[model samples]
Target: MTATAPRPETSGPPALPPLAAQVERLVALGVLDAAGLDAARVHDAVQAVDAPGLLVVDRGLVPASVLTPLLRLGDRAGFVVEDMTDVDAFAPTDGLDVPPSPVYVVTAPDRGDDLGNWSPEEALPELAARGRSPLLLTEGLHWALQVPEVVERNFCYMTIGSRLRKADGAYDARTPAVWISLGTGRDGRERRGAPKVGWCWWRNRHTWLGFASGVDRLAVPLDG
Candidate 1:
């Protein structure tokens, strides 16, 4: 009989570390997992339990269930816990209004080809002509949001609510108001788990968002 090649094993999303790590980092420290928790829920959790520090693990983007708890924890702790997801969270009630300015987009130079939906480099030239900066938003997790001062020193984009407004100040149709840069290639290597920048309210699957250095503020309207 001829030898045959063996099939490779398929896999699901990577498994996280043991639950103990979670307990030690969050439950033990008196910190709550605020990223995945909602405000009132977080308040309830805090009131129910006793701890010192909180650690919220976002398996993916920030969800309302997760954010509400963090908000409550922020109220109790006097500071917001770190957001582990690659995107930021915002209040849904807040309105989305683009000031009359130039919009800048940050993206990876190499992976832009694979991003069939959007192109940062191609989009930036016109924006720059209007005096805006096109930054390349990078990929990372919770640690990235920690250095607000550094982010502020580098990028030009701003985070806002998901709802969009028209010229008359009325609500626009509830489209997927946010856009996130998933990555640039078919292999998914360049964009997997990359942080996105967009409105906070559009937390559903279709919405996209990105995270950029705080220093590079956009001068135009970023529809995503």
Candidate 2:
């Protein structure tokens, strides 16, 4: 009889953007608000990124939690979270089983230059135009419960991933539940990072979160 070989075990925790680095990046981009960014907020933001797992825990769609508060703190913040059932207004044409979370739509500033020149006035409308619909507004935790599937579907379609650790010291896979502005532009489009796919687990002890593209691309001020 031939001997069978055993499968090798995967090693190490999944790779993720450093929480502090992410916060710093948000601050540098002027995304962080005056209420101030802190470690707890960073952790919460990270957890919210894993939308799917969060839904499972919370038993529904994930809310805007971290993103909403942060955006609200910023100047000239705008967003909309429309129901998937209202397909006439949203894109892709597919109906979502879950409800929608508040979408942050900020106007891009009309700075003469492209790099870090965005002002509040220019960014708001540009962001809102990307997604126009009746958005639901509520706490992050509540949002997660209302539309778990919708969150998961968006993550899948957008090719985003998430990492989560539970408070009870458990590990679970998560998918991006919310969208945000990714500074990096790619292929005439923007490149954002999330889980690769088919990798969704989480620890009961840790929180979950995910990220997605807020707008197709950074909105540059149109010339009159």
Candidate 3:
């Protein structure tokens, strides 16, 4: 088998919106309402942790179950794969301490395009070696929501930092990812170009899907 060449960064990381603007985006998406969270309180919390970071709403406030369908890229809305009805079941793997707060920030996030064609099992150690952490599924969604350009044709990413732990204590092999729908299969013709929350097997690799990662996470202090 021929070895595939590594891909380059799709482009420089697109600039993220101001933290305040990002909070309002959540409001616009009805995330606040769906989460039963007050927009003002959410806004204030984000303000306290404001910095050059990607604002992410922890699954506690709004489950991936709810947020996936609310994602928008251009005229199309986001969706979870029909087979992935248990999307919320996936959680941060052991040792990946996602903040307990409802809103937090991921600093210096990147779509690891250079790691394209590498399987999730292959990429995790590389990310740790680089002193970076893999992004959670929701963090990837937050990045796309704040900067839609991160997701496009021929360039999308995986969020393998999370995995589903079965009742037997073995982790499910399906890893979550965010990408553009091809408008084929169960996606329906109209969903082409829409953002999609889906999954891939831990050992599988796709030439176009890269792993997403970040330098660190900055949690807003829980006690205000």
Candidate 4:
């Protein structure tokens, strides 16, 4: 994730923005909210079209069909578009292995009070030692529905495929946990200088869980 500074300022035209820019454009257009969920559309599209977004592929429909419509909307609205729905779309960064497939984990911090299936004692310290303040739940926030006493020591594991991450990378199963600091997570306030190891995702009924990545792969996309 560590790349040296710029080679030189380009006198030529600027580069195209990354896919995130288009996503922002979508937000401004009411296609999605600041949280990135196309609520009304997700409901409408799912019912009427039977896909969250779609393209009439041949005579059938595709799953997670939001990509095409977004691309078309980006073009129609005059913005650069890129497909970033998956890790395969991003230009790889060194040591940026995928985090483990997220599970519906409802856990609380291990404050010497015996509770929860997972009890991570070293992950937060390691990340802190590396000067990384991973995202966390705001104190007094009941987002995870964790019982009052055992709330907020949230950590997520990494994955290689649909299975779990079994590689001997720096963040393997042995040392596979990452931290979650306090903040307005869905508001995108967590983005900044440090590399984005992973992200937090949840629904009204789901626990506020996150993915932890070791590599930093952030390239600002254009608004075009």
What is the per-residue lDDT of model 4 for residues 1-224, given as tens digits with 9 covering 90 to 100?
A: 12222222223212222233323443444434422454444333323221111111110111112222222211121111122233222221243332231111112212211111222333334443554332221111111111221222332222111112224533222221112323234324432111112322211111222222122212211121
Ranking by TM-score: 3, 1, 2, 4
Clashes of each: 47, 54, 0, 15
lDDT-wise, the better of 2 and 4 is 2
Q: Rate the local accuracy (lDDT) of all candidates.
A: 0.26, 0.26, 0.84, 0.23
What is the model-wide C-alpha lDDT for candidate 3? 0.84
Indicate which candidate wins on TM-score. Answer: 3
How do the residues 115-212 of candidate 1 rate in per-residue lDDT, one tens digit apiece?
12222323233343444332222211111332121211112132222224556976443321112233343414443323333332222211012222
The C-alpha stretches of model 3 lying farther than 4 A from their native spots are 1-9, 222-224
**lDDT ranking from best candidate downward:** 3, 1, 2, 4
Model 3 Cα lDDT, one tens digit per residue, 1-224 = 22556555356557888888988998898877877777888777776774678888778777787877777888999999899999988889988978777778899888988787888998999899999999999888888877888886667999988899999999998999999998999999999989999999999989888899998788865444
Worst 10 residues of 2 by lDDT: 107-116
Residue 101 of model 2 has an lDDT of 22
The residue pairs found clashing in candidate 3 are none
**TM-score list, all predictions:** 0.20, 0.20, 0.91, 0.19
RMSD of each: 18.7, 20.7, 2.3, 18.9
Which window of ten consecutive residues has the lowest lDDT sum in model 3? 1-10
TM-score of 1: 0.20
